[model samples]
Target: MAQSFQFETSTERYRDEHFLPYFRNGVTRGPMTAETSDIDGLADRSRTPPTVAVVDAQSPGNVGTIARAMKNFGFDELLLVDPPALDPDGEAYGFAGHAREDILPNATEVSFDHLVENYHTIGCTAVTNEDDHSHVRFPYSTPSELPDRLATVEAPTALVFGRERVGLTNDELARIDEICSIPAAADYPVLNLGQAATITLYELRSLTLTDEETQLPDLERVRAPEPTIDRVYDQWAELLEELNHPVEKREKTMRMLRRVYGRADLTTGEAIALLGLLRRATERPAEQ
Candidate 1:
């Protein structure tokens, strides 16, 4: 049977004690919004290159705002991999202003793997330090380095982002070169996806100062290698069959592990380390 909604008998008292004053004072329940005035003069376009992609973006407004930001910062190619929803003529366009008409229609949509495959280099952003993020460059080097990197970077550089609710998945995390993160106050570290992308692009634009700065002389145009996930417990599949561990139990354990590691935003290096740990653990004989 379907569950039915339940009403509290003390609702009137609860509201009087709790919600009444807040409502009367014009306070409402919702997420905080960052306040800012006009951004026309402040938006910089020279920092970003022609190749950038946002993956699995969940919000329609976020998608449009990010596209608008890309246009503001002189970025051309925008890829959306299985986005949650999009509104071409909604608030996104309102924020986009002139760029909306051009970008919203032509923005490319592709499978996540296909987008990663096309990019010469791919990078991701994360908030926490996991094994994959052990090598963090303080002050965030991507912005400073992007101009030089761009001069020599080949077509299609993937900038993988995550869902608003949870960020990127482990499978997605494994597909990028490095996991980039903004060092914010510990009290409020996670940034909204659109804001993070916008800031990152702006920082990269800031670095495009001079001809000397823009030239990365020796960097070669090598294709970014694809990232892969090797489930260590695949071996456990056979062991579960042999030892008769319940299928549901094995699956639950695997899913929980995947979620934990996924949240860490594992980069290629960290994934390797984690896989090594798993390999060692799996090599031992099953408990009696």
Candidate 2:
């Protein structure tokens, strides 16, 4: 069943008046369009990644999945509120994969109030209001926008996810400083608890991880140098010339070869091998 909640506007005025201007400006808008200046200003500021917090989570397996997602995204700290037993031998531990060694075992159990008081809490929800009439879910940032919204802050923060069944209560969301939502079809926006957590964490990974930390192969290392690529083009021209490829058509053929090689993004080794083959073709006696 999709978890849906009706929110009251009793606290809307309070949030508008008390919270940061960014939040107020975000109301009635999608993805904080008017807050670009605010976000850009904070772009170079120090960043402290938020702790992943699950509230009133009923499923141990879901909790484990969240932990694994955290590990994949370079986040470590986790806080649980009213969580089920995560026995070492149980589903939580079993599903945690490598995270059981660190994120799950070291998770802290804290009250919702404690989470709010100690950190800048951003609640994750699938539901949101379209207009400024309600503050609880309106003016929410989508998960992809979180890194920009949070890039400047240095304070401790928590990315709060609610129960698998009903999600966070309206009251809990009312107290949260900000709201983050994953964009989905309007008719059925709800996502599985673990999937929601995973997607949100993946979006926020830029704040927690550096390019070097990800250890992905550098493009410079894999791609042939411009000079090397030029050599391949030169070789192609030579091969075409040796074949008595018509002079009028040779230039066009070379142009096509350039386009093909440009799109291929051949590696250095591949380029060298192609150069050798082209040389051999050019050197071979004309087949008569």
Candidate 3:
């Protein structure tokens, strides 16, 4: 036999508080549109969409605007450090426009050091430091040059922005691996915090994920085996010895030779062909 249970208190109040109501299309309680994460598509990309880090921002509105810029350029991850007081109904969300739900609500608060330890930090600056000093450095690549440069990076990257008044400190700049400055004319230079972020994201738009529609290559050749490369090196060493090359310089020469071949990323067939040519060249000594 089963026992029946009854609740004396009303459960109707809980429906509107937590669950989606059966009939009402309430603005505040309505279904929120979410960004669909395309994991498979992201895997094909060489680099991830950079996490935007705002350091010591004085205004909440600026943060929201930055998040809006990120959504426009297909970036989602945001990191805030020493930010101003944020209010849901404040100008922060108002400035966010449509990206309010996408970026601001999900924004992460993290320490500046945490971003340094995890992702490759790209320091954003308007000032160009054209020096060879260890502490002071020029950008590794300009905005237009970033596509080619960042294409080879297969790791997580972050773009760090500083406060409105004074940009990133010298200590912060020194620790950064790379720095990027938006090229501006001398007559009317220096854009605002939001402008710089928007421009940077526009230039780096290629790194963002897209629809999984890119076709794969038909055939892919594997690299030459380690043994094949070692054998080729051994043969080259024997040829160098037979030529009476300077013994003192041979080791350095061999290392350079290794780098030359390594850059080729030779296949087994190509390695064998190169090894055969070395044998022929060694067999004939000056044709004397």
Candidate 4:
């Protein structure tokens, strides 16, 4: 049996009772009209990424996994509609990893209509129409394309996913402003709820994360300096000479060593260690 959908008529009461308090601390939600400009400037305003909303998610563990994925991609605000009970010591918290501390605990419960009224809702679905004849799911954007498409909009947005089994019904998709689908093999395009959210969040990471925030190690700080690298090459040459490498092959061997080192992207410490080992090898007497 298909689930019935209804739009909530009392918007202000719902917003006041359920929505406003969750955002009072730091999350901002309001209409972003043309005349309304953020006092912090557009760049700062655009930094606010889309909220992640799961509609009628069945499993607490899946919800937790989605929360974990949200943390991985720098998104914090999560909205749930008919979600499972996330006990402190339950699978939801266990699977949430670091997200249990913030994302899962702070997730707000909202009605589907609250999302429609308060946000530019983008429905994520595996099933899409093949042609423009049906507007409900046609003209959908892939997850990778969302960043450029949503770059300038300052309004609050929501990436809405539906139930694990049926997903969002036709009626719900019809009400959503936009649709986003992940491209997959024709035989099976559907993904696990957590997987779908993770992939979509990853593709949209550029919207929420900065270059400094995403990089693992500061490349400039770790890369070996030019002089240090030169010393490594010099040490290699000295070691080769000490070993009495073939005269004709020495230059080629040195060139090969340079290529290998160039591709290694060795850190300053690694270069120094290599230089030390080479120096010791060059100075050590051959075994009699």
Candidate 5:
């Protein structure tokens, strides 16, 4: 890869005449990690190709469906979190069909903490919004929006799928970096695991790859974690209150600001600048 990071939207290979395609490009043999036994088939976990992580799933059939979807979408790394141990001879193989032996056989089982510790970025799937406004998983992004949201992350990233029945717990969702939702018919919003996985993978593939001919202005990209964003928002809240902004509107105003900052996708420096701006504007004896 020309750049340290490789970007691919979905199962399709993004090939440019001027740039080497990741799928067909030089894959020089590399050494494995010290913890190599736990992670399968990857030397550089940081630049993990698009991956899928299953959480507490019960169905072998669904896992098979997911594996088949992975094959269709060009995803190879699969992670399982407390899911029913895969039955190799079961419907999983039947559904995986061609990918049955190759990708499915290598799926790794890890803890929720393991995912948080390893991947550079993590996205969890959900059909409904969490009731708590302050939940880390809140302010969800659509599957189609995910690739753009994570365009800068060169390290390994994963899209996590929860159980068919209840989906991800708030705690599980908390450990993730973002939520990728599938917008659907309001009357029946949710889809089955297989359907959801396929749609998500397809949208991920559908993103237009940037090329030498592509017209775009590159900005200063930065990585700001949720915790930092929250701290900045809290400082903003103090500023709003100092200015006597109505109590009824405080939460709403904070939310709007969060959306503004979140959309900007500021780096640590950018976030710090904004936080300092608010403190300076609201400087008072109490605040000082």
Candidate 6:
């Protein structure tokens, strides 16, 4: 006779790491939306690990896969910031299997800023160096840096990954405190969204201790939010437009500005400082 199985309630699913509970008659079965209560129950029991947010991703399959990877890697929080064409519980659960439906039912849908409000440290991964090196100047941080920095963390941290196509917008990246990238062949630099999430989580997972050990970076190292960068850039753009400066000159000046501040990787405080400076500098010319 075939064995019988039934989906667990929300409370039971949080602790269930594998899909066994959802199997019916010894067959793995996909849960319909009604089963989300089980996943919710699971979520209540489990403490969220650092969240991994995939922003503006286009493929639902990839989203499901990433959630699966997160569950495999022991990350509890899977956030989707502005994803396109997603049916959170329907299509994604098929890919997540039974182990990680918490991500499916309760996947936090938030703006980058909103996500950061709860997280103390946010790391963003980019495909290319992209003329900015605030979070990482070296190709990779030493193994020591990972555990040591992660150890001191007092609040929830988020590993923010970009979209499948363009990756994190400058605006999105700007909001993060640090940036990370997987070492890929130069010929083709981009990794799929799922691949990037898996690798990053893999690297981070290796650092956990029997006792939680997460390092906090010096406050100065944090980068300003992407919106702050947008505000600064917008100011610069407005100034150039107001001056009616030659396009080439404006472009050149903006490039130089990027080189200076982009390398410094301004923190939240630092960005505010710079914006204040711009406001002062661009104040209307005093009458002679």
**How do the residues 1-288 of candidate 5 rate in per-residue lDDT, one tens digit apiece?**
122334344323322311232322242112244543332222234333566888888888899999888877667778888877577777888888778978789887877776665554455555556655675666787887877656556544678888988777777777777677888887887789889999988777633233332344564365788788887988988888899999999999988987888788878887788888888888866655
* TM-score top scorer: 2
C-alpha displacement of 16 in model 6, angstroms?
34
Order by TM-score, highest first? 2, 4, 3, 5, 6, 1
lDDT of each: 0.56, 0.80, 0.73, 0.83, 0.69, 0.62
Writing each residue's lDDT as its tens digit, candidate 2 over 1-288 gives 111112234455433322333232232111333433343333333444678999999999999999999999999889999999999999999989999999999998877777776677889998888878998887899989889867755456789999998898899999888888998998999999999999999998998888878868544457799999999888888888888889999888888888898888899999999999999998998778
TM-scores of the candidates in the order shown = 0.49, 0.74, 0.56, 0.73, 0.54, 0.49
lDDT of 1 at 226: 31
State residue 146's C-alpha deviation in candidate 4, in Å.
Answer: 2.1
- What does candidate 4's lDDT look like per residue over 92-136, in tens digits? 999999999999999999888777777778999999999999889
Ranking by lDDT: 4, 2, 3, 5, 6, 1
Residue range 1-288, candidate 1, lDDT tens digits: 001112234655533532332232242211222311112211211222445567777677787777777776666566777865556556666666666877766677777766554454445455545543544422233444555665544232455667876777656665555455655777887789888788777766543344344444554333222343444336435445666778779888777766775565556666666567656655667688
State which candidate, 3 or 4, has the greater TM-score: 4
Clash count for candidate 4 is: 0
lDDT of 3 at 121: 79
Candidate 6 lDDT, tens digit per residue, 1-288?
A: 112223355544433532443342342223334444455543332222566788777888778888887766666666778876556466666677653447666676777666555454345454545454643322334222554565555334567777778787766655566656666777886778877777777677754322233343434267888899878887887777766779879888988887887888888887888788777766768558
RMSD of each: 24.8, 10.2, 16.0, 7.6, 19.4, 21.5
- Candidate 5 is scored at a TM of 0.54
* Clash counts for the predictions, in order: 4, 0, 0, 0, 6, 19
- Candidate 2 or 6, higher TM-score? 2
Which whole-number lDDT from 0 to 100 does residue 184 have in model 2? Answer: 91
TM-score of 1: 0.49
Where in model 6 is the C-alpha error above 4 Å?
1-48, 88-90, 128-145, 207-288
